[model samples]
Target: MSAFGKDGVTGLYETHLPVARLERAIDFYENRLGLERAYTNDERRVAFFWVGGKQSGMLGLWETGTAPLGMRLHFAFHASEEWLLDGCSRLRDAGISPLGFHGEAVEEPVVIGWVPAMMLYFKDPDGHSLEALHVLPQPPDRAFGIRSLTAWRQYAS
Candidate 1:
């Protein structure tokens, strides 16, 4: 059995991203995206939500401070390839041009060695880089037209 036990799906959790306006961010995730509210700690300044069947926990909002410029840290969620592509499409429709690692559209999905998963990354409304990934590659025997990092680099070269 791999690290995640027999089925290999371990516990996946979420981390809070600091925001300036709690209400606005909550509105974005809760109303616009229709995520279900899981819980909130008003005095402690935290709110949790469930998006796409996953518990997207506490999004911390620092009411007074402004977010730093170029906030590189981001939060990610697991999604299907279709959802990933659709997210890209949504960004495009919203007039946000997302560039892949190589500054191009993610022409195809890829598995990052660091995370050992197939992923596509993009930014959120705050320019925070976010990723939607599968925990593992589609079985090698399956024909998803996917490629490993080395393979794509070598093929391009």
Candidate 2:
């Protein structure tokens, strides 16, 4: 018997990122980003936050003894352009600048050249790459396909 149903696959209730300092990450997520710290497990060197008042979904930070610098990994979250600007302002106030901006707000809202959206990338305290993005115009219609023939074969075969 399988529990899987029409929903296909379940999404993660929480996501965790390892860092060097829990306190700093907590301050960034809670104070700057306006998220609420829900729980902290000092023994495990873990801290959690709840965003937008949702308790089930959480962002977790893990204090590690040794971690690489300069963006060990990159991830993104969706937000409005206003939120992106506000977040960017807060990060700038804290002495951090985004990597670059992408999408429509780059002097081209919508055209044959670029899509309608904006992306702001930055690094966390431990140098993990993060981005906040907003979609302006809706995407064009298209049939989805694997990027390469090898990918299609790997999935089909």
Best by lDDT: 2
lDDT of each: 0.56, 0.60
Tell me which residue pairs clash in candidate 2: none
- Candidate number achieving the greatest TM-score relative to the actual structure: 2
lDDT computed for candidate 2? 0.60
Question: What lDDT is obtained when candidate 1 is compared to the true structure?
Answer: 0.56
The alpha-carbon deviation from the true structure for residue 82 of candidate 1, after best TM-score superposition, in angstroms, is 2.7
Each prediction's Cα RMSD? 6.1, 9.4
Single out the weakest 10-residue window by summed lDDT for candidate 2.
104-113
Q: List model 2 lDDT by residue over 45-77, tens digit each.
A: 999887545644678888877635423666666
Which tens-of-lDDT digit does each residue in 1-157 have in candidate 1?
3666757754555565765566776765666445677777777666777656553333333333554643346666667667654655655555545455544575455655444556666654554566667665433433324455445445334
User: How well does each candidate superpose onto the true structure, as a TM-score?
Assistant: 0.57, 0.64
TM-score, prediction 2:
0.64
